[model samples]
Target chain A: MPDARSTPVTAAILVIGDEILSGRTKDKNIGYIAEYLTSSGIDLREVRVVPDVAEEIVAAVNALRARYTYLFTTGGIGPTHDDITADCVAQALGVGIDVDPRARAMLLERIKEADLNEARLRMARIPFGAELIENAVSKAPGFMIENVIVMAGVPAIMQSMLDAVAPRLRTGARVTAETIEAGNLPEGGYASDLALVAKAHPGVSIGSYPSMTPAGFRNQIVVRGRDGEAVAAARAAVEALVARLHAARG
Target chain B: MPDARSTPVTAAILVIGDEILSGRTKDKNIGYIAEYLTSSGIDLREVRVVPDVAEEIVAAVNALRARYTYLFTTGGIGPTHDDITADCVAQALGVGIDVDPRARAMLLERIKEADLNEARLRMARIPFGAELIENAVSKAPGFMIENVIVMAGVPAIMQSMLDAVAPRLRTGARVTAETIEAGNLPEGGYASDLALVAKAHPGVSIGSYPSMTPAGFRNQIVVRGRDGEAVAAARAAVEALVARLHAARG
Candidate 1:
């Protein structure tokens, strides 16, 4: 449906948990999801982490869903008192929630009927007209409502849920990137020139990351764009500039 | 400034980088900063990750600074082309940015005058009328403008910077927490009773975290509040509920 000069498909990740805000749990889901979406040709533009509060979740969900093509939320869907993500999501979408037959079927495959206490049944709750995202780690499945994909907070389970929903997403052109090692050259030596190159190749996003390596603080300049020619041209310009600066030092 | 009871001081962290958005670097600063601020009695309620764009940085700085008592930003402070956090911060605060004499003095503690090239000198730039947050790990310093504190992305350097600013912050009453181990009980088994416990102790924030340990999916309930007595009371109720459930199972 997009024209030749189509913009990239964008997504935002919302991480919901009190444990994370409290610094009790280090989140592993955001990075994993960012990498996965990037490889799948989706641009992850923004990420937010909020505590397990109903109003907070609803506000964030509404804001991000309206802004991006998709919004992925992790955590707070478990069978506990603090796991209010589902109810909050339902309220955000203005949809009534009940135990979905598909989700209950998935749970019944792993949990016996006699063992299906109210606690385990809590995982089976689904928003109106949502599709179930299968969880291979545990039988408790995640669900997708409209443009938002809700998944588990645990790394292993979220990965499985992501795999289940990947096929349904509308992908875009994969971004092409080229990295030029600036050796030991300080970024300040070529910052102005790099800016000129970036201006010249407006399509390519040129970035410089400095690391304190054994050789010293080495700068790595990266140029990324959907157009291969633009990315490659920017990379060549950066390399040429760096070579000039290094020679000037000699 | 307060007569008797004071409102809790809240904070937010803004993580800026293209590497994080592109999925090349997994973020380590948010968790470290979140935990550090929590122990200091500042509630880290929101966290956002945005790319190294000046507009994005300025927008986040403005939003977070206006909303929270303190806003901490990590990344984009290095001496590289993408390290525009200084300029962006100045713009956000509506101030001029130039090389700070104090920061230059700190850099001179390590590097000689002749060796201090423009790239290395980039680290000395600070917003107008801002306080420097010392980085003992490295010679480069971070800075604070108004309520927003800017620090490094590297864990060691950020930790040292946090220590420098920790003493200067207007911290509120420290949150006290009590944790009760739920043994091998599933959270679903006690979700309802836990909700009741939470309702009765409205002052305390009770949270349930489920993790797959060697024993299995064990629930760890944490009760947190500014009032130690309230936290302790809620924790006792959770413990009693777990003990009763265990006895019934036996």
Candidate 2:
């Protein structure tokens, strides 16, 4: 077991959008960010999707930012009346918000000053004492206040914002995983054996997932851990168990 | 504003899975249920996704089930060792779980008795005193305890389970909405006007979303409310604003 790090870096994602909660939009950002954070060695422990309501957003932001090493929020940062994530984040941190010069400069790169109306300027309103997270796709930069990092809800922009912020994030040991396909074998046939394997490889996290499609039930087992040695050992054990099951059936 | 229902019925979704958190699977259930619940007059207030940890599932269940009128959970009910949603749910409700004869009978309709191994039998486990939600896609049944409805993570199965449980839920007045597309008008160009419209339509929720595609930026404005009159009124105002912007450009 690799317990090298005394405290592992962790994060929680807060997806703020009424459209998402109302089911008008299928969220693509959560999976993208989750995979990115996992690969970057930041444990994405929790994700909460709240509507555009200010109170709900504030409460979630406060709770999540306090618990996780970092809090990443997507959505509600647009130039619309319902876009209140910036203000809600300010409320959560008890900081005043205004149109920051840095963010305004970035916005100007896309829109001329004459064309920058109130709605467009809303995107530039940054919380006090926050660092800008450059939006490479567009000019409206996301900002990081304390431990909370806010980004666009749109998949493409959110991906760019994540890439910009990832370099500065405090990361821990990345988890490594191995998968073993348990073709046609019912989980019931190998459930007990899998549990025993899990018990033996206490350091690795083992999971079995079954999907029933036109082809029928397809089962896959995965083992994950930070320690490469532990993951390899668990993979070997799982492979042996599956091989034994195959032999018994034959 | 339509205040037809004295208190609106609300719901929260608890998505439990390791594959989803690992980013290996893009969640399709949340959006499906969100749309389903919205049309059924159940306001989906919040959504939380957690890993396959027992304690995390228990905590999320306790928090969400306490706050919302209904708490729907998806995933972790399969016939695998990692499928602990049933047990964790029981722990959250302070109840015991066992293989229910009703669920087993349902399972037997599909699987032969000889093939019903321990793993397959695991799927029949339900929390004590809970009502079973039928899975039309498969024989495995989901159960509802108190306000919590547990279902399969697979999109097809989850939809069937939700359909089975929706009729029994205490739903409130359904929300109606209208959409206004601002094809080329920049949100910044009319942001102040949009805010004024939002203030006028306090009973309705107004939102603007801008997307930058290969063609260019496309903006969409949506107005939503439980009141037919209020929603219509907001829609008219948004249409007029977009029209005025068009005239100015001409």
Candidate 3:
């Protein structure tokens, strides 16, 4: 059996909302969570954005939860009618959901007793046997059931929830990355050589990314791996290839 | 049978890139395509971002293609070794892929024949039975096979390819949206009333979006539907509810 420390921990993110699908709101959470997970030693393998339909949310929750070590979802955890993530998660997990005393207390921090109507209480709904994740920005807590961690859609609130829940997660070896700038050096010039470097390094992943700037196509070759030495070796090879191409051009 | 014209046209976006999954590149194509599809009368149903791993790419392509009316993929169509989207799409659809003469001609517009080495020639590879989608910014063409449209990852190139392909697609009734700004009035105050309004308007989708501004929480209630009359009616109801809440506060 492989050592527990060597086994990779992977995750998937589910972003739920109709606004994101309609392009009314550009998603800020997916990228933020991806970077956060990368830095935290959790590999973000996949991301899906689904609308606020119950079946879609429930199906995605079940599918993703079974596939990854952790499934983190953002959105639809508010007081409004469309905020149905908690119930959907409960349904997905086959667990009963009710107003949790802990979550209610958290909500009470921001809302007055008289104002804690049915609508506000919706924010306090937690699945059975789930643990509440604290929110620093807003008091309505996010929750974790099984491997799924649900959080708010708002970026600030989501960031806070992530911070609260991150410490409890099982993390793998941190993947280190080295970026080699191949500025103005056309991808075609180094594509074949980079392919060879990538093939030689079995442990690392090498990618050539080209973005169009006002000046022209700015290219970046990135080498990444769980092993720092592998990443550095592949990065060095890529650098050498770029240098060779530059010299040949001269 | 339902009217063919009234039947909703749906799409899913499959973003194939390690850069996006690793958070090295923040995805700009998903939002751009989402808004474009909304305007073009196609409901953007789901989105998935997967790494450049061939199996993952093939699985996502097959699943999304089978589920939605159309599936659009971005990234991995470049000249580099990691640019394996074409081969993956071909494998998913069970079709043969090769360097197409048409695509070669298109590439020739931008690249000299002498410089069209094996790496550069990789850009000309197309699935056997796919129609090329034109890229105005960069000449290497995208392609459409059956219901799946494969485009470049670069935002500008993807936009141009989308523009080229949009005219040929069968579109549904364009969904219209009206935004009612619910300034400063707390969501808790109007949540219940808004739920009733949503229930009353069966034809429209009502979503209350709250964003944190420097000043405070700025809320917008959006009413969206294919029927303009239904959308307008829901918008009016929401407007009245907001007014009532403001009057009560005053």
- How big an interface RMSD has model 3? 0.6
In angstroms, the error of model 1 at B139 is: 2.7
lDDT of each: 0.88, 0.91, 0.94
Candidate 3: Cα lDDT at A22: 93
Least accurate stretch of 10 residues (summed lDDT) in model 3 chain A? A1-10
Stretches off by above 4 angstroms in model 1 are A1-5, A213-218, A241-250, B1-5, B115-119
Q: What are the per-residue Cα lDDT tens digits for candidate 1 across A1-250?
A: 8842386789999999988988989998889998998888899999999998888899999989999999999998888778888889999999999888889899899878987877678899999988999999888989899999999998888999999999999888888878899888766667777878888988888888766666567678889888888888888888899889999989
TM-scores, each model vs. reference: 0.93, 0.97, 0.98
- Show where candidate 2 strays beyond 4 Å: A1-4, B1-4
| Weakest lDDT window of 10 consecutive positions for candidate 3 chain B | B1-10
Q: What are the per-candidate TM-scores when only chain A is compared? A: 0.96, 0.97, 0.98
lDDT of 1 by residue, B1-250 (tens): 8621267899999999988989878898888887888788889999999999999899999989999999999998877667889999999999999999999999889778887777778899999999999989778999998998999987778889999999999888888878899878877778888989999999999988877876667778899998888988888899999999999899
If both were scored by DockQ, which would come out higher, candidate 1 or candidate 2? 2
Q: DockQ of each candidate's interface versus the true one?
A: 0.64, 0.77, 0.87
Q: Rank all candidate structures by their lDDT, best first, as comma-separated numbers.
A: 3, 2, 1
List the candidates ranked by TM-score, beginning with the highest.
3, 2, 1
Tens digit per residue, CA lDDT, model 3, B33-109: 99999999999999999999999999999999999999999999999999999999999999999999999999999
